[model samples]
Target chain A: MTTDDPSFSPPSFVPFERLCLIGLGLIGSSLGHATRRAGAAREIIGVDRHQPNGQKALEIGFIDTLAPDLETAVTGADLVILATPVGAFDAIGKAIGPHLSPGAIVSDVGSVKGVALDVLTPHLPAHIHLLPAHPVAGTENSGPEAGFASLFDGRWSILTPPEGSDPDALSRLTAFWEQLGATVEIMTAAHHDLVLAITSHIPHLIAYNIVGTAADLETVTKSEVIKFSAGGFRDFTRIAASDPDMWRDIFLSNKDAVLEMLGRFSEDLSVLQRAIRDGDGATLHDLFSRTRAIRREIIEAGQDAAAADFGRRPPSRADDSKF
Target chain B: MTTDDPSFSPPSFVPFERLCLIGLGLIGSSLGHATRRAGAAREIIGVDRHQPNGQKALEIGFIDTLAPDLETAVTGADLVILATPVGAFDAIGKAIGPHLSPGAIVSDVGSVKGVALDVLTPHLPAHIHLLPAHPVAGTENSGPEAGFASLFDGRWSILTPPEGSDPDALSRLTAFWEQLGATVEIMTAAHHDLVLAITSHIPHLIAYNIVGTAADLETVTKSEVIKFSAGGFRDFTRIAASDPDMWRDIFLSNKDAVLEMLGRFSEDLSVLQRAIRDGDGATLHDLFSRTRAIRREIIEAGQDAAAADFGRRPPSRADDSKF
Candidate 1:
């Protein structure tokens, strides 16, 4: 659907009467900017326990109004988003459930969907709708100030609606994302969690681990690590710079899946280490070749899939030259 | 130390009568091109065991002449650079030893200096001078065809010269790199190897290990690894994409230092893994905060140092938002 068509011109904005966004961190602030830009709501109010962050978000125009109390923010809101850290879900859900408007939809931007749904659903009001959502777009930078208006553009916004949900509301929510330049995808909460356990969750945990490992090398001077990082430590340093609280919650929430993946990664590493120890260059070469091919495949598929599209032309990994 | 006075520049256009480059890989080719562009060489000759790389270097204008035999390249050259893989230094030095010219300055671009000196010095003619060098700039990409003009811009090129070496030859080589837009630093061969083992060599080995580990995971599908790699794995892919031959030689030649560093790294990693298993959030947070401070320090130093200089900028760790 081209935006040039009169029908595709978004006839009119389907505005939520009141949208309560919890947390004033990077994701929440970006969502506040995105919703306002898409004109998806009449009033965008933010709820946070941190008084300074709530005040900062309002001052920076991330939200139209700031509410210090979570229950008060959800009192009459049509759409309530729990954008806090994944570990904070249960406490926030219990506090806001009783005050949610009838027929209002509650969603979240937590990374682990199955855990988020589990923590959120049991405490929610029976009259309200619980739709767990996760937008797979972020940087190491955090806080309200670190966010920008275009953070979600061309990225994946995964919605995991529980079975037997209202179809019309789902369609409306999907359309809302499409209008904001993000491609929306629907998946089961359990499947989404599993896929991300391999993709986003475990990778981040490993990155964090390696970075921690590099930081702990007391025998090697820190200056040396920074200087010749061109070899590989530079890459880990980037990941290690990720928002600490967000990643902390992710590992805590997806503990089982993360531990399982970590075990596999460790096993694979031991084999490679043994091959290197035994001077088996062929084994290392073969694995490197296979992984290089996989990198090429990813650059292609990511451009085709509406999810996490980097926009513009494809960046074939062919330009990757490791001297 | 600045190129501010164009009038006081070194004597212009002293083209070498004969210049021999032992390896036609990325660094050697870039030096060839820069030498040609600066009119510093009248005849640029390259030699490689594999005839194809030497031929490619000639075809790409990186070298004016090609030598299928190492002796043919070394016979009449005043400046002979052994730019082959570090592991191949012994074989190349033995092959070219008897053919060296009377006052030839034999230098190299190997990453590890101690190993290079160990292999090359014994085979060198007494009259021939040995100046071990390493250009600390490279991409993940390699080969003769991958060379570019600006690759050495703003990069550090360290020269590890032996005690009581010919001052005139050393001054000429330093002038050579300065003309190529690199800041030249002089240091001892052992110190250079130790510094690089911590910086370049260890980092490359770690990246290769982690990337190989992630790729060999049987439980997590390859497709999932590719999809979520935008989070942090992309950086690993870039680092892991470096030339296998170069890295293979790096580890083989610098075995002792790399093994020592690897021991340090593994010990540190075990401590971190224990902390994570014990759920020491405070410990994790403290480490994260310290790493952040280190990153800032590197940036500040680079920024401050390069403020007055023309081409010696910091590494690109700060460029990407994902990092």
Candidate 2:
């Protein structure tokens, strides 16, 4: 099913009779909204370590009910989605393992897939299926209030099922994401880790690092940086403002891939540094020009809006009310 | 003169009898629209080496008329603004020098102020005032058609006037930018370069470099990169898609400061890289959390709109026809 086709509906078969979401933050709450909108689940159960977030999710109408504990949440659920930071997967898997009903499908929306398999597989019961999924979409915002149903529209959702996984469970999860307005792809957990290392993890690391570097500069005060941020520094701040705990977990879990991509990035940056120091206009121009093409491809692929300024129009009357 | 006041009018003093804008691209054309909207200039003349751009600027009503050549553009103009790439300043200054009317105040909207002084000062006649300015605002879009009148609203316009320059001319230029809807500040050319190095130039360089690094990864194909960009890499792509020629000139012109800031960035990144390699979650979390505050400061200072997702709402019917 194509995500671009707004009229497309999920196959008549329901993926899960009862879906339990283990976290109620941005991704989890968004999933709840999408599934409820698509009628993809008969009942949606929300659980969060922070009780207030689960309450918020229930009040927001993304979930039909809120479970105070994992055992209660997963007791009769046919599908259990672990939607927290990657670092929490181990504990979550162990906690939900015994409570999960027989033949229940387990999935997650973590940024790193390889580590998800390593941490979750050992704890999960063999009778249940574990399909690791990464929905390549999000805003920097966090918590239930920050999520909207359309977050995954026209975005990719990659599912990485370990070898010897049940085919029926895998397709059911894929159908669930597609119904929620995402094009789905399947890949190995290892490859997903490497791809996201460069595309997501490393880019986030660089954004955080540069913002830190700019803030620490003795020559340019923090006020100056903020005042002049329209000159391009503000763009980095958006990505850097992402959930700190989530990113911290991603880096630690995907340590090897993150380090490899970081190494490549540093090497490439050093070359740029040298060119700048040596007054290499041609090198800078060529590199800058080539990167422009990638931006075009991304816009064409529908991964980004084609708007001139990332579609950041001046506030209208409605926007003022939001503030 | 508050930029936030949409109904603000320039304080009754017209800064220039006639304003000539050389190189009618994004910056130049935007200046034309702004000056015309604010009635800051009595007559605005557009000049571009690419004749179509001049014609487009006139058709768009951003300028009163189009001048066929640099000589004609500067002949009767009291204010001549060089809005070309910094690299072209030497040739432009030389071409327009002999024709510039005495007492004409010459200024530029180049990103690199120090180089603007170095390149344009030698070629211009001593009678004409050279007041270099950098308006710290723009989108990634280029060309005359991409210009908009409100681009400078709530943004900073930094002036880097040379020492011993006529105070009257400096103040006139400052008043012009202020009337065009920017808050004005004065600083040395050296200091401006250093400040922008961290805030604008280095951020752009890192953006360009990271996009390039992602595109060239052998394991991750370009298609995957594009598909998954929304995860984080797409933010960098917006900045990277900026006009290549302008960025090339900025890197070459502001080599010293860019290199220095880049050095600091590389060092900071190296430390982060080490932390990640050693699985240092605290460092990553601390840095990521600190940067979030900078984003807050920028939004509070009115440098960025506080709308979630950089104010990118899904296109309503009003935005459809914009394409």
Candidate 3:
């Protein structure tokens, strides 16, 4: 069902009778909205450790009901998604394991898939299907208020099912993500972690590190950094502003792959540092030119907008009020 | 004058009799458009090593005429602005030094201010005032076609005048930048380089390095890198795609400050790498949380839009046609 097809209707295919989201932050709340819009489930249940977030999701009209606890949330649900920080997965897996209904498909929207499998698989029942999926889309903001139904539109959702997993559960989860406007890809949990290490995790780590470096500089004041940020610093700050707890968990959970990529990044950076110090314009120019091709491919793949400045509407007094 | 004030008029204050823009690329063409709109100069003469670019700038109506050479462009002009890659400034300064009218305020829109002063100071006659400035604003896209009048609106224009410079020339250049909708700040060229090294130069170098590392990975194919880029990697690519020649010049010209900042960045990154390797979530979380405040401050200072994803409009089938 292509998103552009006018005759397409989501109510015809309800994969799960009830869908329970265990966290109501940006990704969780967005899932709630998209799930409801796609009619992938007959009922949507939202649960958050912070009660107000669940209340906000309910008021937003995406979730039909709010669950008080994880055990209660998983009870009677055919599909239960763990959507909190990856660090919380181990304890959460144990807490909700006994309460998950038989034949339930357990998945997550976590950034790191390898860790999800390691922490969650031992706790879940053999009868339950554990499918770890990551939707590679998000904003810098957090909480229920930061979500919208279109968050996953045209984004990639990778599902990593362990060996000997049920085929029916795999297709069912794939269908759910596709209905919510994501293109799905299946890969091994190990490969997912490796791929994401370079594409997502390392980039975020660099952004955070650079922002920290700028702030700590005795020569350059924080105010100067902020004032002159448009020269390129401001872009890094956006990703740096992402949920601290969520990112902290991602780094710790995907430790090996993150470290490997970080090492490579550092090595590459050292080369650049040497080139700059020696005034090697030829080396710097070639690298900078080659990188531009990747940006073009991403735009052509419909992964990002081709417009300048990410198509941000230029700020004006009139435009400020609209925001 | 505030950008929001409807009563503001441009023709009331003309700062220069003839505005000679010595390079018809993005910044040069943009200066032409902005200067015309502000009525800050009586005429705009554009000169480019690439003749087609100068012709295009004239056709776009941002420039009143196209000059055949650097010497010809600065002849009889009261205001001469250099807008090419910083590396070209030395030769261009020498070429135009003989032709510039006495009492002309010669300035540039180069990113590196110290290099501008260092290279251009000895070539020009003392009768001509030399002022270097940098408008901390740009898009990744380059060339004359990418130029727009609003490029500098609400952005900071930093002016670095050498000691014993003419006050009238300084004030005139200041007024010209202000009329073009920039908030102007005066600083020493050395200080400007140091401030920009952390805030701008290091961020760009890091971006370039990360993109290069991602491209060179054997395990992760370039296709995978592009597909999953929206996760965080794509943002780095945008800045990495910036004009290679321009960036190469920036790194080479500002080598001392860039290397200084790169050293600190490497040191800071080592600490983060250690934290990740040891699974120290607390250290990671503390740094991540602190960086978010800087993003908030940038938005508050109007250096960037507060909207998520840099206020990029979400791509849809309908929006694709609009682009």
Candidate 4:
């Protein structure tokens, strides 16, 4: 978990002879880098519809071969991962199904698990083992150059294998994520979607919504908001800056769960709103105190750094001297 | 501002013969550190109703003297800053008003500006200057041990001077903040409250609200939420961990503006919810894309670090090797 240490490296183990990663953005490229570092795959064959992303991954040296198309990428691969936005899964699944080798394990790194199963299962060949997964990790940045091998270190990769899945295939996929430095959790796709709805999907929606609200404020100038953002507003912006298309797909694909959670969030917010309006300090204090404990749990759980302000670089004597 | 770099110190100037700060938490203690570093006061007097907090501030060497009571702390100080939560301002202002020296300039570092003026103006004598200011900076941590001199470096310090205030007092307070490594902006008390309601107050509210909602979910275990927080929930928890009492006072003191902004936020969120429920990808994508631009503007304005994940430490090869 000491990801910043230069002298550390994970043990190398190959779980797949050929791994085809379709999509060369942040998650895809990061998987390539981590797989190479962990020796999780003998060869990482990368494919992106965007040629420059593939070229950048090649330059980054995580991918052994850059394929121009999905069919070419999956032709001889034993493990094929669709790493694109969840919205793109249906077409990619259909296009690459006929080309996948028998006994190959097909998986995904999308944010929503249920949709992956709903869209991918129908198109995949029965000969190929279909397993879906979501690595609950990412930064706000995109593109191949944004990737790093340690992105998954100490993170969770939740797998949603259908009922009666091949145990060997499930074990191998779990081992693959483990080699890449992620702890694996197995759950039903429905459960995974519901859990992520509260944890991931809704948080992203709220971040995006708050940022949008800040932007449309007629009373507050956009420049003023930007300049004074070191206030709590800036924290929301980090996640709001995440890839638009990907999140759009997440919100649309996981519509029911997201709406359910959003309703609960708004309901809770209204209670706080009433409390603030009524100057109900006790209610506000109780909720704020309860939330503080959760943050401690998160840091203790190693889901976040224990350092204050996410260990952001604090102004030092040296920094002040310049002003 | 390169605040993490050591071996740097700023030129020092003293604006007050004796300065008293009336709280020993994150902002107050940081003020002591930054003030001492800038040589802003010939003698620093610290006051905290909490005996341990006062002793810790003295032990940290930021204060030349620790006073157990506000009256004793402000006895002969030329400048006094009320650094306690907004709720305490009324009592402290009342206690210290008769004890303050003539021509002394009194200020505060409270988040709600209008409340500071409302609570302090009545207690303060005609000869004393009541200038309220807020330094828009801090980490989530609290207490004297969390003090850092560079906390305000490159941040804004907004001064809300009541009408026909002493020009010399205002100028001196502005210079004191500048010397402590902050840029000074003068605005009305009401404007400061409204701007910050969006920039700071409501963001904290939404963060606290969401974390509470997550903790209350029956379908999703708290452990699952914590383990998978990297997806986005963890970002909110950072702000949610901020001092509970301080935030409780902020919401109560700035009720109108916070409520107004919250109403707008809810209206906008309702639109997003509808869009998601109706499968309007374009609506979600457009807002997400627009918000990303604001984040870029914030970075370009030098209000936030441009580094991905707020420059959070990413997993590296060595980190993976451990797993």
TM-scores, each model vs. reference: 0.84, 0.93, 0.94, 0.93
Q: Residue-wise lDDT of candidate 4 within B196-285, one digit each (tens)?
A: 999999899999999999999999999878877888888899999999999999999999999899999999999999998889999999
lDDT of 3 at A68: 88
Q: Pick the candidate with the highest DockQ.
A: 3
Off by over 4 Å in 3: A1-12, A313-323, B1-12, B313-323
What's the lDDT for all of these models?
0.70, 0.85, 0.87, 0.87
Enumerate residue pairs that collide in model 4. A8-B318, A9-B318, A9-B321, A10-B321, A150-B315, A316-B3
Q: Write the per-residue lDDT of candidate 1 for residues B199-303, one digit (tens) a residue.
A: 666666655665666666665566556645555565556666677777777766676776666666556555555656666666666666655555454344341
lDDT of 2 at A67: 90
Tens digits of per-residue lDDT, candidate 2, B155-234, equal: 77898889888867766787888788877777889999999999999889889998999888899998878767777888
How large is the C-alpha RMSD of every model relative to the true structure? Answer: 7.4, 4.7, 4.6, 5.7
**C-alpha lDDT (0 to 100) for residue B33 of candidate 2:** 89
User: Tens digit of lDDT per residue, candidate 1, span A1-323?
Assistant: 11222432333447788889999888889888888888888899898888888889989997998886988899899888888888799999899988888899899888889888889888987888888888777766678886776667766678888888876667666676666556566778876776677667656665555555556665556655565454455545556666777777776667666666666655666665566577777776776665556555544544222221112122122211111
Worst 10 residues of 1 chain A by lDDT: A307-316
lDDT, residue A86, candidate 4: 94
Residues A129-248 of candidate 4 have per-residue lDDT tens digits of 999988878889999998889888777788888988987787788888988888777889999999999888898898999899989989988877876778899889988999999999
Backbone clash count, each prediction separately? 9, 0, 0, 6
Q: Which 10 successive residues of model 2 chain B have the least lDDT summed?
A: B314-323
Per-candidate DockQ versus the true complex?
A: 0.21, 0.53, 0.56, 0.52
Please give the lDDT score at residue A39 for candidate 4: 84
**Top-scoring candidate (TM-score):** 3
Identify the CAPRI category of the predicted complex in candidate 3: medium
Off by over 4 Å in 2: A1-11, A313-323, B1-12, B310-323
Candidate 4 chain B lowest-lDDT run of ten: B1-10
